[model samples]
Target: MSGLNIISNTSLTMFILIGIPGLEDANFWIAFLLCFVYLMAILGNCTIVFIIKMESSLHEPMYFFLAMLAALDILLVNSVIPKMLGIFWFDAREISFNACLVQMFCIHSISAMESTILVAMAFDRYVAICNPLRHKSILTSSIVAKIGLVAVIRGAAIMAPLPCLIKRLPYCRATVLSHSYCLHQDVMNFSCADISVNIIYGLIIIISAMGLDSLLIFLSYFLILRAVLRLSWEVRLKAFSTCISHICVVLIFYIPFIGLAMVHRFGKRSSPIIAIVMANVYLLVPPVLNPMVYGIKTKQIRQSIMKAFHRNATRPELFH
Candidate 1:
C-alpha cells in the first residue's frame, strides 16, 4: 500500500528491458546470432508467402492457412526482435510506457493469432485427409476467409485489454522488465498496484486462446490418426507425410513456450539468464524453423520454390 502510494506519486514514463543479464560483454556476439536468426526468419517466411502467391498449384486451403501462419510469424517476431537487436547492439533499451503497451499488445495478439492459425491448419489437414471428397466444398475460399477473420478477432479481443489493465497499475520499482520485450506478465511484475485482476485476465487470455487452441490441434491430430489407421499402409504413410511439417512446426513453437512457462512457474531461484534465453528461443525458433520444415518436408512447396528459381534463371537465357 505504501509502495502503491509512492508509485502513484512518481508516475512511470518508461521501462528498461534487462536483456541477457551477466552477458553484458557478450552482447555483440549475441546480437550477431540474433541478427542472423532474424534474417533467416524474415527471409524464410517471406519466401513461403511469395511462392504461395506465385504458384497457382499452391492455391489450396492448406497453403492458404500456411500463408497466414507465415504472415503471423513475420509480424510476431518483427514486433520484438528488431528492438531487441537495438538493445543488444546499440544499448537502446529504454522503451516508453505507451510504446511498451503497444508492443505488448502486438506480441500477445500475434501470438494468439498464430496459435489460432495453427488450429485452423490442423482442421484443414483433418478435412483434407479424412474427408478428401468434401475438402474443397467445406473449406471454400469464403470459409478460409472467415476462419482468418475469426482468428484475428479472437486474438485482438482477448489481448486488447491487457495493456490497459497493466497501464492502470502503479509501478514502484525501477520499471525494469526481465526480457527484451514487453510481455504481459513481465510488465505486470513491475507494478506496485494490486495485480490480481491483471493475473486473472492474463490467465483467461491464455486459457481461452492458446490453451484451447493447443487442445483442439491435438484432438484434430487424434482424429486424423484414427482416420489414417483405417487406410492401407501405403496410403497411411502418404497421408502422414503431409502432416510431418505441421507437426515439426508445432513442436518448434510449443516446446519453447512450455519451457518458458515451466521456468516462470518453478524456476524462481534459477538464473535470470535462463528465462531470458528461453524467451528468446520461444520467439525466435518457430519462424526460423517453419519455412525450413515446410520446404523440406512438403514436396509441393519445394517444387514451387525450385520452379520459381528455374523460371527466374531461364528469363535471362531467353533474353540472351
Candidate 2:
C-alpha cells in the first residue's frame, strides 16, 4: 500500500506504552525505586502544604508561592508516575485515545504551571530583596492569589489544545510509545498525517512556557543581585540566604530540562534509554527536591516540622 493511502485510511483507538526498552528483567526493580521516589515527592510536598497551612507565619507571599510550587510539583509528578509504575509493574501499557489526551494535557499543563509558578516565586524574591519595605504592599494577598490563578490559567490555555490537535491526525505508525507516558512529542511521532502545524504549535508553547519564564526568572535575579550588592556584607548574606532554596529549585528544574531537550533533538544516535531517563528526571527531580530544599534552608519550616514530630511523638504516650 502507498504511504498516502495508509495515512488516509488508518485509525487507532489506543496506544501501548513501551516502558524502558531492553530492560524487561529489571522492570520490577525500576518500578520499586520509582515508587519510592514518588512516595517521597508526595510526602514532602504534602508536608510543606500542611505546615504552611498550619502556621500563620507562612501566610506571607514567599511561603504562599512556595506552597503553590510544592502543590504543582505534586501534580506534575502524579500525572505521569502512577501510569508509569503501572506499566512497569503490571505490564499495563494500554491507554485509550481519550485517556492519553487527558494524560498529555495534564502532564504538560502542570509542568507549564510549575514554570510559571517558579517565575512568580522569582518575582516575589525580587520584590522582597530589592524593595524590602514595599514587599508587603506590592505582593499583597490579592496579588498572590492572582499570580496563582494566572499560572494555572496560562498553563491550561496553552496546553489544552495540544492533545486535541494531535487527536485529529491519522496515527498509522506503530502505536507503541518510547516511554511510559503520553508526551506530546512522542505521541506526535506516531501520526502519519502532516504534523507541521502540531510541531510548530508545540514549539511555540515551549518557548512561551519554559523559555520565556526562564528568561524572566533570570532577569528578576539579576535585578535582585544589583540591589543586594549595594547592601552591607551581613545584609547581602541575609538577602541571598532567602534566595538560595529558590535558586536551587531553578537549577534543578532547568538543567535537566535543557539536557532533555538537547538529548531529544540531537541524541537520535544515542541510547533511547538516555532520553527516557532524562525525561523522567526532568519531571521527577524538582518536585522531590523543592520541599527538601525549603525544609532544610528555611528555618521556619524546619522548626514547624520538628514541632509536628514532637507533637506526634508525645500524643501516643499521653493517650496511653
Candidate 3:
C-alpha cells in the first residue's frame, strides 16, 4: 500500500479509518441500536437546551452553565457519532487528513471547554451556597458571560497546537487511523516521525488545562463542604442537594475520561476492541447522561422541562 503513490507528494489527502468491529459483518441490528442511541442523545441534549432558553425563571448562573454544557454536549456527540454512523450505515469511513485534523481540533477543544465550564459551575455553586449575601453581585450575568469567553479562549489555546503537531510528521506509511474519528494520540501514533515532543506537549496541555481545572473544581467543592459543615442541618442539606447534580456530572465525565487515557497509555494496541469500546464510552456516555442527570437531580430544571412540554403541547397556536 505504501509503494502505491495514490496520494500526491504535496497533498496530504484521504486517510483510511478502521471503524468499529462487528459492524462490517453484522446485520441491521447493530446499526439500529447505534441509530437509536444517537437519536436519544441528540433529542435529550436539545430538549435541555430548549427548556433552559424558554424558561425565564432559569436565567441564573447555574442554569446558564447547564445550558452551556448542553450545547457543548450536542457539539461533542455530533463530532464523532455522525462519522461513526456513516461508517456503519454506508461503509463511508474514509476521512481526508485535513478533515481528520478539523475533527480532532473540535473534539479536543470542546472537551477542554466543557471541563472549564464545570469548574465555573462549581465556583457559582460555592458563591450561591456559602455566601448568599454576595451571590447576586458575584455571579452576575456579565460575569457568567466572561467565564464562558474565558472557557473558549482557554480551550483554543490548549488544543491549537495539536493539529500542527500531527501535520508536521513525515508520512512514511499510508495514513491509516484505527478509530472512527481523528483522536489526537491515535493520529500521532501513526506518524512516521518521532513523537516524543508531541507526546510531551500533549501531556503538558492535559496536566495544565484539564488536570489543573479538575483540581480547582475539587478545591471549590472542598470549601463548599467546609461551609456546609458550619451551617445548620437544614441549610447544609439544601446546599448539598443543589450540588448533587453537578457532582454526578463531574463523576460521569472524569471517570471514563481518566480510565480511557490510562488504557490507551498502558494497554496493548492489539486489543482493538477494548480501545474502540473505551473511545465510544468517552465520547458518548457523558453526553447521553448529562441532561438526564441535571434534569432529574435539579427540581428547577425538571419543573421547567415539564412546563415547557406542557406549553408546547397545549398552546401550539401561541407558539406558532
Q: Candidate 1 vs candidate 3: which has greater lDDT?
A: 1
Question: Any residue pairs clashing in model 3, and if so which?
Answer: none
TM-score of 1: 0.96
> What is the clash count of model 3?
0
Off by over 4 Å in 2: 1-10, 317-320
Clashes of each: 0, 0, 0
The C-alpha stretches of model 3 lying farther than 4 A from their native spots are 1-9, 316-320
Please provide TM-scores, in order, for all candidate models, with all chains considered together.
0.96, 0.95, 0.93
RMSD of 2: 1.8
1 against 2, candidate with superior TM-score: 1
After superposition on all C-alphas, the RMSD of every candidate to the true structure, in Å, is: 1.5, 1.8, 2.7
The sequence of per-residue lDDT tens digits that candidate 1 reaches over residues 75-147 is 9878988999999999999998898999999988988888888999999899999999999999999999999
Candidate 1 lDDT score at position 14:
86
TM-score of 2: 0.95
Residue pairs of candidate 2 with colliding backbone atoms: none
Q: How far in Å is the alpha carbon of 207 misplaced in model 3?
A: 0.5
What candidate 1 gets wrong by more than 4 Å, as runs, is 1-5
